[model samples]
Every structure is written in structure tokens, then in C-alpha cells.
Target: MADELVKAGILSAPEEIDKYYLHGSGHFIGLYTHDVGEDPDNLLQKDMMFTLEPGLYFPEEGIGIRIEDTLLVTEDGCEVLTADIPKTVVEIEAFMQS
Candidate 1:
């Protein structure tokens, strides 16, 4: 995620991002980012689903955006669940002003 953001000039470097962020939103979405699913030792078997939702918050820029996508893990590959939210600059501005 950091690599992609750096390539797009959205972030100066991966190290600029904090190591951890409080999940103030919630955790019922899926397996917590910390992988504390009541049984941390449990191994992912099959049909397990999760999310990789890291965010960047820059209060100086009045920008607090989190790019999240729910994923379905299978034996073959994975699938994105939240692919409808707009992430572009114009889209976000319109949304905020609206």
C-alpha cells in the first residue's frame, strides 16, 4: 500500500506512515487488523475473509482518508468487496462539500 501511494505521489515515503493506528471506526468488519480473532493461533483454513484497510490522516492538510476493501480469501485467489467508493480527488471534494 505504501509502495503504491509513493508511486502515485500521494505520500513522500512509506516510512512517513505511522506503524499503527487506532481502529476508532470499529472492528466487527472482519478479522481485526491485529489478527485477534479470539484464537490468534488459529490458521486460516478456507473461505476466510478479511480486510486490508490502512488509512492516512493528515490534519495539517485537513485530509483524513482511509482506503479500505473487504476481501474474500479462497483457495484460488481473492475478491474485493467495497469497490464502489470513489477515491479520486474530484470525487472526494464533491463528497465533502456535498
Candidate 2:
């Protein structure tokens, strides 16, 4: 999740989730939710990129929180691509209020 955020230019650094298990281990996202959007045998190249989403869905708790972002694999490092979406708590509150 952190990788995705940073690549999208939302965060300046990486973040560590204390409990990532309850909140989705991870996922491979793209044009399709279950299938790979890119080539099947596509390898991680110098400018490769992908999405890393970690989420927690507790229907009983009435809470379904998922953090997703697209990341670009560059020669030097990675880059985020979904910074346009509001994922922060404050941003979410503001959006809901609007």
C-alpha cells in the first residue's frame, strides 16, 4: 500500500501497517479485478508498475476499509499513480461532509 501511495506522489515516504493480515494481505489489480491487466508472462522491467492494495472488510463491524494505489517500478525506485483518490482519514471525512 505504501509503495502505491509513494509512486502516485501522495506520500513522501513509506508506511508500515502494524496489522496487515486482517486488512487484506495484498492484491494484483488492473483493468480486471481477478485477472492480470498486463501480459501473462510479463516480467518486472526497469519501468514496470503495478497496484498494491491492502484492505480490511468487517461486515459485522460495519466497516470495509481498503487502501489501494498504483505503483511504477522505475530504475531508481517506485512511483505511485492513484494519488488523485482521497485515502486519508481527514480527506474521507471532508468528502463525506461535502
* Colliding residue pairs in candidate 2: 7-79, 7-80, 8-80, 8-81
Candidate 1 wrongly placed segments (more than 4 Å): 3-13, 19-43, 84-86, 89-98
Q: Write the per-residue lDDT of candidate 2 for residues 1-98, one digit (tens) a residue.
A: 66775687745666533333364344455456544545646666665556678774545567767687877778877777787788889998999999
Q: Under the 3 Å rule for N, CA and C atoms, how many clashes does model 2 have?
A: 4
Instruction: State which candidate has the highest TM-score.
Output: 1
How much does each candidate deviate from the true structure in C-alpha RMSD? Answer: 5.3, 8.8
Tens digit of per-residue lDDT, candidate 1, span 9-54? 8678887545333344322234456454435457654566666676
What shift in Å separates residue 63 of candidate 1 from its native position after superposition? 1.2
Query: For model 2, where is the 10-residue window of minimal lDDT?
Result: 16-25
Whole-model lDDT, candidate 2?
0.64
| Cand. 1 Cα-lDDT | 0.62
